[model samples]
Target: MEITGNKFALIGLGDFGAHLAMVLSEKGAEVLAIDQNMDNLEEVKDSVAHTVCLDATEEKALMSQGIDEYDAVIVCIGDEFEETLLVVTVLQSLGVKRIIARATTPRHAQILRHLQIKEVILPAVDAADRLANKLLFQSKLSSLELSSDYEIIEVDAPDKFVGKNLRELELRVHYDVSLITIKRIELKPRLLGGTREVEHIIGIPSPDTVIERGDVLMLFGKKESVQRMMAD
Candidate 1:
């Protein structure tokens, strides 16, 4: 998605932060990548809008870079919890528009929450969860957690769902799950001759929309509700 003109500051150019910087830049956001290590700075310097090697915990150094002016500042110092917390606190004191911090553990997350940081990311834990989901659910293509209770998952349509219209399925009433959209495969002719399959989303499906074979359903609901729907 294009996020042109949006500005973001990422403090700590660890693996997660570096990757995030590249992604944000690719999406057309202006990203400032920061880290104390020159090596880390060098890695993302060409990708992001700017790269600076400076200790984030130092308020003066951060202020000099206008950290508070950005749309958001993400603290990604994963190795050192103390340093992460300190940097977050400094960002808070600087009156940053938004602050997101990375927590290495549950306890670390709790501490960040106590510090009144609204957004905390546990990248390792999230990655593990996603991997577990992929391993456990054969039909599921991907899943995104919106919160502890809710998730949006993409799954191959079950046998019973094919040829059935949404109204006939009564997904919301019976399954307690919402089908956000449907992805269908269509064949497009290639320049040489034969056709190639391309997956396209049929946006905002209606009650009469029928599910075709090989359709991928994007469903959103409580984890248990979604699991029940898929199971049945």
Candidate 2:
């Protein structure tokens, strides 16, 4: 869960493994990247704490490198079932504490699950879900995922909400959303009498603050409620 120690071994330095290694390292984790391919190892050598050209399926070789002592081991040789299975089997035999694996197909996921691998990632499916969410909330200025069920989105106030105030909407009571902030643009007369649009930020608006048209709201709530509010 925490990726900041020198306690992770990332095997099969493919795209996923390499990127993960770099990210963990960037977050202050000392990552050891292993790959049978010299080119793969070379590409990520300088980025990680260590890079090993290793045939990880060999139990003796894997253990010799002390990979079993790591807090977690990640297997990314998913396309090569035999190699991946052997690597995981060796990790188990060595009593590695935690294992994360990538699943190339449904069958691969099932097989890994049968091995009692607790965390399995299906990259394509994960990517597709992310793309779908991007499309679903594309109209929003931005969307931040706080958890699987909660999100914060900055969206244009719904048309029906124009001229309505926070108390009148009863957002929390009705929609389970909190109007955190409102960015308002209004025309104000200058000292010379000519009016110019001045920007005003309403921070944590009171119950009676009216929601004028052209207001951008930062709303926080459950994903379902936010989605429903945006749609309705």
Candidate 3:
């Protein structure tokens, strides 16, 4: 998360925005947090490099702060779409290089697109999609957004492949996919109950590494390639 030499301006000091600012600061980025609410500003005063109390819709106040110099700006206001749009417009007009906005609904996202906002995030919708996929698939596969055509997935190890070495399977050549990580799990039970241990294999495993039952593998490649691999 440490983005060296990156300066970020976060508008809005709500829960999401405040947490983002803290993360960015922890990652070695200089974060400037802005909010009209004095309480919000006070809450994150010590978390970020700078905390300012100002209406983000006010162009003059924003311009006075020289936010244009920052590398990136994120608009995290959720409730007021008008204020969000105004802030995005003002930031774009000020020549901000990269602007990322959070939108609540699809309609709001469309408005941001019409204004030519480069990045719009719908966290709730995306989370719901992930959750739904997890429940329906029940195959340990999770959602991945790589591109219009390609996707990465994480899934439990296939039953047939268990106890086999990577070299014997030839995953990359045969399936056109790459394993990224092996997720391992270790369980500790109470003294009264017997203990159990579980591990999930993931990623491009070493050729010598042995695949076991109940392991999880994180794979990355084109969707078609991934499907072919899983089928094999």
Worst 10 residues of 3 by lDDT: 190-199
lDDT of 3: 0.77
Comparing 1 with 2 on lDDT, the higher-scoring candidate is 1
| Model 3 segments more than 4 A misplaced | 1-5, 132-138, 141-232
> TM-score per candidate, in order?
0.61, 0.61, 0.59
Candidate 2: clashing residue pairs, number: 0
Q: To one decimal, what is the Cα RMSD in angstroms of model 2 from the true structure? A: 17.8
lDDT tens digits, residue span 1-232, model 2? 2233466999998888888889888878878999999999888888899988878988888988998778789998857887888888889999998898887876787777789886776777656644764465464434444767666767788889998888889989888988888877665543322233444567779999998877888788887888887787
Model 1 regions lying over 4 Å from their true place: 1-5, 139-232
lDDT of 3 by residue, 1-232 (tens): 1123579999988888998889888878899999999999898888789989998888899998889998888899988999998899889788888888888887787778778874676667656644664476555454434677666677788887888988898888888788777665545342223222333234456888787755677777887887777776
| lDDT scores in order | 0.82, 0.79, 0.77
Those runs of model 2 whose alpha carbons end farther than 4 Å from true positions after fitting are 1-6, 140-232
Model 3: residue 180 alpha-carbon error in angstroms: 7.4
Report the lDDT tens digits of candidate 1 across residue range 16-122: 89999999999889999999999999999999999888889899999999998898888888789999988988898999978888888777887887888767777
Clashing residue pairs, backbone N/CA/C < 3 A, model 1 = none
Displacement of the residue 120 alpha carbon in candidate 3, Å: 0.3
- Per-residue error at 217 for model 1, in Å? 4.2
Which should have the higher TM-score, number 1 or number 3?
A: 1
